[model samples]
Target: MHKRVTFDNKLLPYLLVSPQILVTLVFFFIPAGEAVVYSVFSQDAFGIEINFVGLDNFLFLLNDPHYLRSFGITVFYSVAVAVSALIPALILAVLADGVAKGATVYKTLLIWPYAVAPAVAGVLWVFMFNPAVGIVAQWLRAAGIDWNYKLDGDQAMALVIFAAAWKQISYNFLFFLAGLQAIPKSLIEAAAIDGAGPMRRFFTIILPLLSPTTFFLAVVNMVYAFFDTFGVIHAVTLGGPAGATNILVYKVFNDGFIGLDLGSSSAQSVILLLIVVVLTVVQFRYVERKVQY
Candidate 1:
């Protein structure tokens, strides 16, 4: 019985993690391997050709204007959303930590938008931006503001980026709140004793201590803006108005599913995967070096 119990204890960790491992293999690793295999070969709707084209797809992507534009647009969108979301999340977290009155109420109100599905949020934003029926649009019209997302490219991009950033604010806040809470009050008290001002204590002690959490949230927010905002774009913009809001993921969807150009789309996906993996690895490495614990 002792030996059996020992065997079960040894196997317990693996048993607990097996479902996650299997899901990763099935959904991520396997599909990524197959995508690499499929990227080297061109196939039509009927799936006839099996010829090895080597790096032809990649070379073609390098020369393709639309692919280049899509890559640039994706970078711009990712940066825009990250900066916009990070600033507000950081400020809100600090305020929530300091405030004595109705902190829970403020947190609950701030996090409410996170409960709304991305697709639903996109639809709601679109409804609000509608020219005729939207309350926002009506207010804009009454104020003599000419806000049109359909024809104008810059305005359209701004609207999409704002919506995407709005969706992520709550997630960022949650991570930041956890980080703030994890910080020991003793440290702050010591800083106060040493004549450190609020701003000084925050920049010198709190910031470095919060490095791990900030790194975590940054990677998460970047990846979310990169891969998961497709539903919002689909519901709101559909990459419309002269392809202004078409980021890489949406471009991949349009190419692979809508246009049936799987080879090019797979190549694009591989590039995206490489970018994300490199960034994530760098983040982990940087955090491991900086984190106190």
Candidate 2:
């Protein structure tokens, strides 16, 4: 049974949450409001002339083939990163859980990448795959494969996806390891005594219990791929091989800052926010039904 603590002083409760409220207002609501306003208006790069454009920016985006291509690219990139990150992390967690020796050391090594900045991770991957001097590139070339992300759009997209997935693996591993450890050993032992094999116990007993953690990670990884992968894209591909890796967040930055299309950029940001919000809502609505807890 959980006890519900009642606050006698109403003002104190409000004060306790005031800081968070203030932060949300300042950082989230304020910027979102600004984006909404800017999205509806067109302004010169210098801010000297402002004009009301209404829905022209959004309509332009809808008609623009490049923008549509970017939308498709973002969906594919997010799914690839989430799946790649989740599967390897789950495998590593299961393996680590079965280890009888040096478990802490193995877990520590797996987690070290999570501490590295996304940009640094991207740089590391970029160096390993660089066409001129990269070791992996040399190996690929030796294997009769032309390895140049700089010149190939599909190759550039794949490289960024790998980098992003690699960066997120450690985070997913931590959660999965924790979830695995929390599962009762008695259940596994009972199943084994009943003549269940390792694979059967895992799929029927362990995997079902880990569903909640998996679901949570799915949402987090999707959000990370949508928004937090900006650094990886920026450092690795810069949305190139002709904008092949231009996911929505990076597109917002590129359009707003580089292209000097503030209205279009703001519209893109609004649309991106809507996308993430909708994705999150859909996950919680439909996916949570599968979670045991």
lDDT of 2 at 232: 93
lDDT of 2 by residue, 93-170 (tens): 999999999999999999999998999999999889999999999999999998999989999999999999998999
With a 3 Å backbone cut-off (N, CA, C), the pairs that clash in candidate 1 are none
Residue 1's C-alpha lDDT in candidate 2? 94
List candidate 2 stretches off by more than 4 Å. Answer: 1-4
What TM-score, over all chains together, does every model reach? 0.87, 0.96
| Overall lDDT per candidate, in order of appearance | 0.86, 0.94
Off by over 4 Å in 1: 1-12, 46-52, 285-293
Candidate 2: clashing pairs of residues? none
RMSD to the hidden true structure, all candidates: 3.5, 1.6
- How well is each residue in 1-293 modelled by candidate 1, as lDDT tens digits? 45453454878899999999999999999999988887887788567766678888889988989778877888888889888888899889998988899999999998988988877888888999877787887898899988888887787788888888898898899888889999999999999999999999999988888888787777778888899888888888898778888998998888899999888888888888888889878877875777665
TM-score of 1: 0.87
